[model samples]
Target: MSSEVLVEKRKLKNPPLNIHTLGDRVLRQSAKRVSKVDDEIRELARQMLQTMYSADGIGLAAPQVAVGKQLIVVDTDPEEPANQPIILLNPKIRRHSDDLALGQEGCLSIPGVYLDVRRPAQIEVAYKDEQGRPQVIVATDLLARVIQHEMDHLTGVMFVDRVENSLLLNQELTKQGFSKQAVKPVEAA
Candidate 1:
């Protein structure tokens, strides 16, 4: 995270943006592609990062905050003093590895409901930087998972929608006070 734009700079006393929860119509809406990455987009990214930190989240997408733009902020390393948060604008997956792995995942929107979801072990993504420059990253492990998970948001998909364990998914969503009907299960490919 840059010193000037760190979440701390936003003063967590109150996050400027509100994260929409599961079953919300906003989360179901697909985000629009950002044609320009200007100060407005950068500010939204910063605010999203702030809200994520406040909610103890590692990744967040524009749709989570009801912003219909293809923007995402990810901080795979939040505990480390040198936090490296990634700001991606209009991200698109270019390629993904054949290997798939199941990982436990949770969401800021669907609080307290964590479940296992399968995802590609590695991926190559093309996205614009905060400054509007094109960039690509080859990520593996947690980084790969985070990118995929957030990308799903861009297309109006939630992690629960990909969970194969219907039993566990129902149990967790019920326990978290979220409706099971909110989940739209997609058969894994």
Candidate 2:
């Protein structure tokens, strides 16, 4: 089966999946690797894409929807109908550039909270396409940052965890009706 999934990049009245928010235990649990790429996985990816678009998000992960599969859907240019969304199964960052960049990021799981986080500006990722064929790509800039951000969800890590400014994080979380305690801060590498 071709990895291409044809989904209109628009919000649906009701997305196929429910996106869990921050402080939800489901978001903190690690995702399991997909052993097989089949129709079931494809359908799940389709639903995830719909949910992401519905939530006005450029990327989404299975764990965000309370699924434990190591899957992620990303569409950086949703306005372009010709642009196909990326679906990766068990994606791994094979290599990263020494250079880093700070970019603001927001999550579907944690709505209304955008903060600056530093990440490698470029990365080489290896993963299986929707058809289960192994593939690799070197991504940079926005695409690289989005990929890294979504991949973090697979390991139960949220962008807020990487946020360095505690005051801003707390203010944003509070303003968004989220608790600061929900953030599990990670040390900068």
Global lDDT of each candidate:
0.88, 0.93
- Model 1's lDDT to the true fold? 0.88
Residue runs of model 2 more than 4 Å from their true location after superposition: 1-4
Give lDDT tens digits, candidate 1, residues 1-189: 233345562338678899999999999999999997777877888889889887888999999999999999988877765667888889988999999999999999999998999999999999988888889999999999999999999989999999998999999999989999898887762
- Give the number of the best model, judged by TM-score: 2
lDDT of 2 by residue, 87-165 (tens): 9999999999999999999999999999999999999999999989999989999999999999999999999999999
Structural RMSD, model 1: 1.9
RMSD of 2: 1.0
**Model 2: residue 10 alpha-carbon error in angstroms:** 1.2
TM-scores for every predicted model: 0.94, 0.98
| Residue clash pairs of candidate 1 | 1-83
Error of 1 at 24 (Å): 0.5
